[model samples]
Target chain A: MANSNLPRRIIKETQRLLSEPAPGISASPSEENMRYFNVMILGPAQSPYEGGVFKLELFLPEEYPMAAPKVRFLTKIYHPNIDKLGRICLDILKDKWSPALQIRTVLLSVLPYCLLSPDYLIFSIQALLSAPNPDDPLSDNVAKHWKANEAEAVETAKEWTRLYASGA
Target chain B: MARKGKEDYYSDAGGDDDYEDYYSKGEDDVCQSDTDDENSGSDDGGGGGVSDGDDQQAMETTDDIEPKDREKEYDFETEDDVRRCQDEVTAKTSELLSVPPGFAAAFLRHCRWDAERLENEWFSDERRVRGAVGLAAAGRDGDVPTALNDRPLICAICFGGYAPGEMRSAGCAHYYCHECWRGYIHAAVGDGSRCLLLRCPDPRCTAPLVRELVDEAAADEDRARYATFVVRSYVEEGTSKYVRWCPGPGCTLAVRSRPGSRLYEVPCACKHVFCFRCGEEAHRPASCDTAGAWVVKNRSDGETSEWVLTNTKHCPECRRAIEKNQGCNHMTCSAPCGHQFCWLCLGSWKEHSGGNYHCNRYAADKSEFTGEKTRREQAKASPERYLHFYERWATHGQSMTKARQDLDALEGGGLDALADTFGVPPTELEFVTEAYAQIIEARRVLRWTYAYVYYQDPERHGRLEFYVFLQAMAEGAMEQLHKCAEGEKDALKVDVGDYGAVFPAGYAAGKLAEFRERLSHLSRVTRSHFTKLVEGFESGMAEIVL
Candidate 1:
């Protein structure tokens, strides 16, 4: 949590995210840890998570910029790709990450889930949530239900979003 | 060639078997390469006909020396050979690309380290080559801008304005502040990206970061990691498909087979042997695909779970595996759960009275497969069949392990007693050491042969009778050898010095000599049997014409 030696690039990015916050999202570094940020992302319109807000925690490790920041959802929402532990199955955070990417870019890139087409951006997070891919699902039960009965799966996802994320 | 040193023991056995045939075949292959080297030299010196003729004569004489005589002369190399091999590629690529060695290495890697392919592609389209490697053509007058040390620039990633001294660019000449570049390069390495080419930060500019710029800006740790990435990229992707790192854990050795060579087992420098066609442990007699499938089928829990599903029922309460051994309606789980239930219906035992036995009626719809009876019969017979062979294989395998341990012990101290009784040098017992090693090798081959037959379904090969005969012959020879060395621990334990006193009647010399001769004879027959079996597989059983 310590930020005694926080790099200038991280500091500058933190100030910019707060000053020019992206639409549908807000993030701020903690007072104790400049590397740690508390984030809130409003669910995209028409998605299962519509009318709800999801809380997430993001941390820049000691090797930030050289390493992707760790991000995990604190609020639980039902989706096939996202696991129960809040891990988003996003490629940009893994093998596809390039140094040209920034925290703002990543957030914008992930925000369109449920609204965008599957191949949009060649990796659409929205398409992933709107239409779960059972082949590479993070939650096996959710994937199975989505495959066996779609209407029931969508109903459970809506219920979860309303219960756990609506007040956030 | 570590193999050369060990091969002498087999040669001394004086058996004109296929074991020696295979050894000489490998040597002959190397001999062909040696002559090719001489031919290239003579062609280069063709202009000076007389001196060239003299040179050719000398080369031919040197080549004529028996490969056996020079076997111990060549030095054995390991991982360092891999590094040297990379250096050769880097040097060749540097010349062709007109770039520094480091830049050349990076560029060659993007081309998958095939220098010939890179050359062909570069000559066909220079512009595409430059663009593909992320280089901008010589920035005006063939000079790459050294460092942006003279002016200031705005970093594209963080939007930080920095002094020109802190800016760098790739071939496209789009510069970014040094801080951003460092972070980007480090992050790329941390994420373990296999992309050897790092592109410019400007979303539109596809120019890759050149090696020189990275060397100047990246930290020592990042630079080292980048170097490793460069080498691995070349070794794994850039080289021929046949080149493979030894699969032995913690072994840094690699081997590259001769082009067009048939797939065979390779014993790596680390002493871990594996099949080249598939990187599994050397499994002979069975083809790579068959062995791989068999290993997976045997290891998966499907068989065990399926057997339990068909043969037993879970306890109604505890859910533990329970077999209905007594064929009774009432059953009590032996576990602490001690739940009682009717085996037929899995219902409460107390409810099973007069007519409750109706649940015992045969369920005709239980199996969907039409050949259920035959399948059940096969299922019952397979393990019994597999066990029949696997047990013998496993026993010999254990014997091999024990023989190796015994050989190691004999070499360590038992040699002194052996030498004292024989009145010969300790080295005289080297043959015994080799005999034990041959036993181990033969046992391993025999073991896999059983596995091969288990899955091969000899009936389909139209030579079931021939397969049975050959299997019997090979197994019979191996079993005799196994019995002599292992089945009776005291039978072949030759502490000749102890035997001298025990056999004061003067039969100790005859006994020890006979023991050595028998060991050699068994090893030879076992070797010949294995060679025939392997030849049968290589020929796809065509030798069994019937």
Candidate 2:
């Protein structure tokens, strides 16, 4: 790991995030591993996944800042881009990652309701859930069902979110 | 007489076409050759049995096979060669800019080393060009003030306070502590990032860092690794149009190809020759795509499955393949399925029992030939066809391998000993190794030629009858060359540890001279024949009307 500054940067970002938590979004570092964060985001209202709380896990590996952080959904969700294993095919999490990006900016852009730009990865995922693009999909079976019947697929997605992602 | 017969045969077979123009132009040479042969009153033995039509075919193929392009040359021997090559480009750019070579090198690398494109962009928008290459304005202020209340300033990355003089700033004036800069550059290099063009540590500023600053900031080990990345960048990213890393494993040499030349086989300084086009082992007489496809197909287990499908029948119940050697039309699955069915029609065994076995002599159905059965028969024949070509292909491949090893042993002191035994200089025996290499190359070509011919669809590609004829000629020449080389190995005695048996002193130097002459002759003949064969294949093997 280069730059004895990664841990310092993460601490500063964590402090700012706690002091000014974005509405409906929270991220706290685990006690055992300071680099690992447990995160949760409330689903946007008026969408099929409304009123559900989605949990995610984010970790900064040894080569943090040089490489992007590894982030995945711990709560199951039905979306064309996110597969059954919760692996999100988001661009910023992969090849399009810039060292300029950090955790606060990532969550702010990815949440369906708090989308800052139309071209961001989270905005694309939200749009994908509302209207799935089956041609370049990650889950073949879900894409097939979505293509064969749109209303039924939406109902199934809502049912999955209510059963698995509902938080007390 | 042969020329007249050839003309008559061509007109009769080809009707009226553009090919007639080719024949008419050759009339003069044919007449002159006929007169010369008559005057000499001599006949060639090889030409005695061949017909006039065959003579015309050979002449046409030989005409088509001659190479039309000039051969290219490239040589890259050392790491210094790469540095010098890059330096030449940098020097040119520096002269035009009137700036330091280091600055020019960074600017050129940013533009992928295309100096003209950089010049175009530089003249079009000077400010944007300067910003892109990270040439900051001379009087621009640093991100941090030169001094803050006469106290030490804190570094943004490590959040550590340092005296103003303790920190360093690049051309962009983005100041960072020395330790932090070293760690940043070191990690960047460790990740295989193109660190030569690493930018300022301040994320908001996209100012590119210069090598001089990086050298001052990095430790000795990281600096050395940074220099390596710069050199490799010249081949991988900087000057990729003409230079490439040698495809041989563990070979550090780079091959520089002559610009604008057709891709050809390149022999590296390491003695590993490969196709510059596909970067594979040299595969002549077969195009790069065809040779690559053949190698990939040869590695798969599809051939075994095809063999199983052709040789056995699947049980109707459990789908297990069963083979019957000597049985009536009645057959039973040998597996736990134990399903009984007719071998001929695959009908249930109950229908063919109790005198219903009369179906054994049943007549053929037209529907069977028109449908899946025909496909099954073709699949059965497919493996046999492949084996026929593969066996010959593999034999030549084996011979080529042995010839390569023999050539290596000969080069390793065998040539010197043979020269001493024969009372001659070593240069006189050089042709022996040269001949063996030529034979090996020709055998490799012959081996892949079979695969090339097998993969060609005759109906679609206009049945390469002429190509096959040239291939046979080349194959015959190769076999003769192979036999001569193998026979020479048996007769020549050498004291190499395990290479050859030593001969008695009674053997004369005259016999050795004769053997050398034969080897040289066969090597030249084999090369010419294969050259003609490659030409025919490349020309799409134009059909001979007869």
Say which candidate scores most in DockQ.
1
lDDT of 2: 0.59
Candidate 1 residues B189-284, lDDT tens each? 654534355666655566666556668878789888876665565546644344566687886655554422333555554445566556776666
DockQ values per model? 0.21, 0.12
The chain B TM-scores of all candidates, as shown, are 0.64, 0.63
Model 2 misplaced regions, further than 4 Å: A1-6, A10-20, A96-100, A111-156, B1-72, B98-103, B127-176, B193-204, B238-241, B299-395, B460-462, B494-507, B540-546
Interface C-alpha root-mean-square deviation, candidates in order: 20.8, 24.4
Report candidate 1's interface RMSD in Å.
20.8
Weakest 10 consecutive residues of candidate 1 chain B by summed lDDT: B43-52
Residue B258 miss distance in model 2 (angstroms): 3.7
Docking class of 1: incorrect
Cα RMSD, model 2:
17.7
TM-scores (chain A) of the candidates: 0.86, 0.82
lDDT for B492 (candidate 2): 60
lDDT of 2 at B252: 85
